[model samples]
Target: MFGMADMDPTGGLWNWAASSSLSGERVQGALAGALERTVISLDAEGMDGAVLCDVYHVSGDFPTLIDVYLAPETIAETTAASAVAVRLEVEIILPDDSLNPTRYVLADPAGGLRHVHVDEVETDDGPERRHVRPCTGDDPACAAAPEDKAA
Candidate 1:
């Protein structure tokens, strides 16, 4: 369901998009992030729009360095850091028993991601987790599961 050539910006690298928000707050946040990171070659649309950047490989590869984060400071959160992996973050949000999965299309690195699919998953340790993987195309909300629909 994703079309390349139209999204891959770098021409050779993996294409990815951030997010567009209904509130437009995300648009401003993306712009601010680009500026803070000294991103000089941003798509024309991004200059005026906001992106819902959930995950980023901040270091591209850093140990304990958490290259990707859920709520990046650039987008405004309780903290400040670099953008990390967006893909992995989505998975952290997935449910363990729910077979329902979502799908997302990656935008060209040059154009940036427009929208994405993320699922929140619970963890045994402390909090919840989000993962950024391709969904199965049928996302049945956990509460909507037939077994629990009665509750």
Candidate 2:
């Protein structure tokens, strides 16, 4: 579980060519279904696990669900003041045959890109939507150490 870094109005979200190589087997843990809607949720806790969020995409007309967890602590950070970070989650339902869900990104690489998979993906927020910041880390402020990675 991870939290959304408060709204950072400083920089732009890192954008890249969209990727869609998610296979039914990629998300092995996901219950088999016809593929449908996506749900995103956020929650906050104390110091230990201050924040957490999950994206659930339901497949087909059946009643199955696919869950993707986002960890802010593991997200790429470019600044130190993530102070305003807040938890934000959303869900969207797509038609049964949505080979493409508006847009997509490549996350969690595996034996090269082919084996790579999608992570923390939501069908609602597409490229048309502008993001203030590339979600900074959930920490009230960037860690004492700046980073180029989600560590």
Candidate 3:
């Protein structure tokens, strides 16, 4: 059962994690069921002619978007995006202990998000400092910068 907080405007986060390899079809199917009402399926063209069926969940009231991609070899394919629905994304452990759905995102006005990094530009009377923050909580692979590291 999902917690009320998990189903609310609270943006759900996920990272590239899994004790065992997960298939793209499995991820897409799971997300489609979890977000059946809001999900929009798409067959996006990828590089090298690799076609990917991506799933996106968008809330009509919020700019929040949940992107579920097919997991490739090694890395799980799925992430959630939100602009201003909440301050921080909450972590939820699914029944499958091997799976990790703790990916998150901060508000991005510039819309610079690549992989698991969010481009954060800060100008405080000095040289413009542009650093990358991880979209998720704490994955050594997708670790956030020291300044943005969670407590």
Model 3 C-alpha lDDT per residue in residues 5-112, reported as the tens digit of each score: 123222333322211223445544444443332333355334442323442222121212233333223222222222111112222111112122222223232322
Better of 2 and 3 by TM-score: 3
On TM-score, the candidate that comes out on top is 3
Cα lDDT, all candidates: 0.28, 0.23, 0.29
* Candidate 2 structure quality by residue, lDDT tens digits, 99-143: 223212212122111111122233443322222122233443222
- Full ranking by TM-score: 3, 2, 1
Which of 1 and 2 is ahead in lDDT? 1
Clashes of 3: 5
Better of 1 and 3 by TM-score: 3
Candidate with maximal lDDT: 3
List TM-score per model, in order. Answer: 0.21, 0.21, 0.23
> Per-residue alpha-carbon lDDT of model 1 for 88-144, expressed as tens digits?
221111112233443333333233332234543433422222345443424533233
- The C-alpha RMSD of each candidate to the native structure, in angstroms, is 14.5, 16.1, 16.1
Q: How many clashes would you count in candidate 2?
A: 15
As a whole number from 0 to 100, the lDDT of residue 26 in candidate 1 is: 36
lDDT of 2: 0.23
